[model samples]
Target: MNNNIVYKNVNLKEFTSCKTGGPAKYFIQIDNVDDLINTLDSAKKEGINIFVLGGGSNVLINDNGFEGLVIKIQNKKLKVVPTMDDYFEIAVGAGWNLNNLIMELTQQSISCLEDLYGIPGTVGGSIRGNCGVTNFEIKDVVSKVYNLDWLRFNDYNFEIKTYNQNECGFGYRESIFKRKANIIWETNLVGKKCNETIIKEKIKNIMDKRLKNQPYEFPNSGSTFKNVNLNEFDSNIWNSENLLVVDCEHRQQVPAGWLIDQCGLKGFSINGVKISEKHANFIVNFDNAKSLDTFNLISFIKQKVFEKFGVHLELEIQLIGF
Candidate 1:
């Protein structure tokens, strides 16, 4: 471990939303670019595998502890700058919590992402996943992303480069960052403005719906898959008139939750790991759940869904550890 980095023999359960996983050989809570670069160098020198962890909202880890270094980002800061009428951009640190950031922004009458109501993880994680709700996604608002030049570590210490929306290949829950691994330091968000009272009311409506529909009592990541064509119409869901409704869309978008529910996966459990009863899309911790249990249940869902529907469900979460 690097003298500059801190942490050792730490359990990953506490950090992850699923509350699963074993201990990590080395761990560091990073707050800035320097710390990230230093830790990357140290990991390379030690010849250990590296896993960059955010809030652990959208991922599952192996029960066996990692034999490598894990870096958890925590640097969160925001700078609000005005650009145009009812338009503003925010330079945000990677570590900022997703919901809290939205809440703060909504309070300021900025409301581009009000519909993306409930999501887990950090801003960087959301960017990595291109998280969205309904038809809106983070990719639409991302003006630029700042990250290290290389995948692991850069001996040349590559300077941060910025890319506009065109360079990032973004689709439902997937982005260029999803395919690439690097330390993301900041992102510039372009948002819309509204009346303060109206924005707050909209946010309240969204939150109220969330509290009524989604379970907030226990920890769990949001939905599990991007819609696919193969698994569409399992229960006559898209049986409307001619148009696709995500429409003109020849491709079908399948919802994994509906399938899981059909497969009797709701409230399914493997030890302490349990699929959320309220929302089949969520996986919850039922007291000291181990990583393996979570892994097993997820596997079980996939197997059954595949057997019945002949389509595979892709994961929305990133897996880090063992």
Candidate 2:
């Protein structure tokens, strides 16, 4: 229960990847599970709302700032264990950077995460969104999730639990963690051993493809909208846009970027935010953008895409403080 971890009136823009948030009224860095529990307890006692921040890669904070406590998880611990057969279990702290973890696993000849190279955010944050690329997702290799069930916080309990893959409720960019407001502590990932040369080549290809298709040159929170599932909508309307649809593990999905691109909204801007010319799915903070600018652009994109194709686009990035 260390009490020296709090800070007041901290600028949140410095903590997010988009770099456009206002100051947090109260901020705290949690280094361990015990400290996080203590901090949450204190905030609860004060009736202050709580926001847990991870790598800050997939969230947009509002310009007005959060009124309550902002907890930044910083517990970084990594472990690797070789079990029977060709299986290797990797345990990563929730606060561990996801790209770093992938690199470390790839260097060790682990094949499970080689295709996910260059994805941003912390392991915990990635799991919250079930982050992935193409056909692979964090849920594929995640065997177990260690977390503090926040629902029990009111009962004076801080006991942590380990949930198996099924209990995690993993679906297209979703998990029970998002619904339960649970605090992810760490995750157990299992991967098969592969030739280091093959793993490196695959990683290289994935990284190159990402660089080519994504707008990484500007400050952005990655994809702004989720891909539309084909089964959910009238398939005949998408017949002409077949080139824009890609096969995902879940189903045939229409890329949100393609929808925005088809609406002629690429490079569209309002204030300082612009839908990236390089990738329509990204709304870049190219000119010192405000959260409101991004929000308005999002609404505009949704309206235009709907008007053009009669399909509504849902946001993938999480909004904070708004």
Candidate 3:
């Protein structure tokens, strides 16, 4: 038991956007990398699996709970450095709130990520998932990522390393962090000097669109499924309706919400969990929903979409403890 690390029981439901999950047997909040490494060494000796938790968005934890240690990141340092003529580099701690960072930068007349306004979660989680909205992704502005190599625990040794944007392996909702299990410590992003008014308007427009289309009033993860790639679908069927194409770095994409809506699944419910009326891709916790409720609902949605459209809907949210 490292004195610098505090461990206790905590309900995972309180730490997630869905607001429905069981307790974590052991939990600790980390403020610095040294303490995290020390605590990891201690936990390794105890033979407990470590689960890192972020801002509690874009995840669905199981009802049975995590039996190991849950590490909540809390570091929140931010720094801006001038790089070139009009572009600047900003370094942010992994635990900083995504929306707050965007707002802070925009207020300073630095606007590069205004398209991602109102998205929830922490910098670490966002980087891990490569979170994005229509036509914009976090990877576009990322300059570098700082992370601790934790997989080499045999020597009880660890080293902090900086990864360039290309080395991060960023794709649509994909990154090296997902595969390497490196502990993200900080991120450096590029931003350009812009008019404050233009940034504000962009934020306003994006937020308004989200409010109008998403189920923000209910407890839910942002999007349940990843958008389908057009190449995966039959051209004749998908093109019949003129499928909306998203310009991604890899390939053309279609909206999962559109597929669900076409299946007439809006407002569908299984117990307390329901497909959001405003957005078919979102499953809302309208009446004290359980983890199983969402799980069963997602299975049902996948089955129906597959049957109707001959397309598989891949999940976007990370499933914890299930």
lDDT by residue (1-322, candidate 3, tens digit) is 3334566767889989989888889988887878888888888888888888898889899998889889888878889887899889998999988889888998889987778888879999999999987678899999899987676754445777899999999888999899976789898999999999999988899999999999999999989999999888886777676677776665788889889988899999999999999999999999999999999999999999898778899999888887
Q: Estimate, for each residue in 62-134, the C-alpha lDDT of model 1 and write its tens digit.
A: 7787788878878787888989877898888888887788888877888766666666678888887888766
Each model's RMSD to truth, in Å?
3.6, 2.1, 2.2
Q: Against the hidden true structure, what lDDT does model 3 obtain?
A: 0.87
| 10 residues in a row with least lDDT, candidate 2 | 234-243
In terms of TM-score, how similar is model 3 to the real structure? 0.94
Per-residue alpha-carbon lDDT of candidate 2 for residues 22-47, written as tens digits (9 for 90 to 100): 88899988878777777778888888
**Which residue runs of candidate 1 sit more than 4 Å off their true CA positions?**
1-5, 230-251
* Deviation (Å) of 102 in candidate 2: 1.7
Instruction: In model 2, state the lDDT of residue 145.
Output: 92
Residue pairs with colliding backbones in model 2 are none
Q: Distance (Å) between predicted and true CA of 179, model 3?
A: 1.2
Give the per-residue Cα lDDT of candidate 2 at 241: 55
| Winning model by lDDT | 3
